[model samples]
Target chain A: MTQANPATLHIISKSPTHQQLYRDIANALLDDDAILFIEGGVYACCGTEATALLAATNNIYALSIDAQSRGLANTTPAAITLISDQQFVELCCQYHKTLSWF
Target chain B: MIFSILIYASSNSSQTEQSALRFTRAVLQQGHSIHRVFFYGESVNACSNLIVTPRDETNITEQWLTLASAAKLDMVVCISAAVRRGILDGAEAKRHNKSSANLSEGFQLSGLGQLADAIIMSDRTITFGN
Candidate 1:
């Protein structure tokens, strides 16, 4: 494994503008960094355009409660860690920095 | 972990601000330190103390004020977004010849660079956007 800066991204946008921004972020990021989708971003778990891009990345996860709240429990795609809030906090503790995008 | 919250939703009739508030409180309950709460876009109105909602409605501005006061959190309103959306503090309102200032107590108007600085200084920056 390559050693680099520990990074994580938290996305909570529930709007189209920010939805598009998430797509852009997923497309531009090539590193092995984790992404934790919460709030509106859970929609991407239901096969949004960004999902395909997420498949290519090695490290990424989505918040389970957020997805369930948005009625995406059954729709969450494979290879995603549907995390509880406690686990989400653990992710925050694990990563050195978090990039929050709307 | 240290955190900075970015609120991008409006103070006007939305769950965004309230959600952000709940999340911040949860973070604090977990023994985390909140470095800042940065308001942008329509959320900038949350800093205005002039907002007076009906008794039944939840007062987001007051909620923010209370939270900031209790925690001594650094509440920052985006200058660009505030000016564009007519959310002016006492000094800016006076400078612009506005009749009143509505900025919430303990909140300060600042540039977006504060956001960048928060990211640099914080371990986590959570965005609550709509």
Candidate 2:
């Protein structure tokens, strides 16, 4: 069973090839946990390298600014939700805890 | 409420240090306390007095030092992370047979357990990274 309060995962690295971190997140996530991609991390929602984790992950989000900056605003798959900075702050409080991976 | 802050990036790269600094200031302005500030990964580099900032640029390390002094906060740099990056305190310098110690005046080198304790004891633990 997962802990009563599971930490939400936040990834900020831009590199899509850090397969180990993605694998770690996949292995650690629980049903109720959320995953957020900010800065260069928005790349996690695209390409074959990301397919497995994206399929396993639920409640995935990407910062709107980062997505727009990278021209991913329109092309990012529906699996990822674009959130504003205000929403980012709200999400921080909404989750019991936050673990940032870079 | 008491807050624990975790910083994982070096002052040289990313805006992690700035974000953590602003958040810490706001936390104090809101009348809250910071139980601990744990510097892990590249963030351990921020504790060194060895850095030289440009004349026109804001000294992020000095900003932290001033804020930490004013707030009387407990700041720790992870020993494992620090030594790996060449941050040594007096004792560590002696043990490692280093020429000198460069640990900033207000910071100390500790262990990962301090991070665990900060997480357990503080009301919230927020991280700032790349």
Score each candidate by Cα lDDT: 0.75, 0.79
**Model 2 misses residue B24 by how many Å?**
4.5
In the range B25-91, model 2's lDDT, one tens digit per residue, is 8777767788999999989988889998889888888998899999998999999999989999999
- Kindly list the per-residue Cα lDDT of model 1 for residues A22-60, writing each as its tens digit: 676767565666777777767777755665557657677
Per-residue CA lDDT of model 2 for A54-90, tens digit only, reads 6665778887877787888898888889987656655
After TM-score superposition, the amount by which residue B104's alpha carbon in candidate 1 deviates from its true location, in angstroms, is 2.1
RMSD of 2: 4.7
Give candidate 2 misplaced runs (Cα > 4 Å): A1-7, A10-14, A45-58, A64-89, B14-33, B55-58, B69-72, B79-100, B126-130
lDDT accuracy of residue B38 in candidate 1: 91
Chain B TM-score for all candidates, comma-separated:
0.93, 0.96
For each candidate, what's the DockQ?
A: 0.38, 0.28
Question: Runs in model 1 with CA error above 4 Å?
Answer: A1-5, A10-23, A48-51, A74-78, B10-15, B52-57
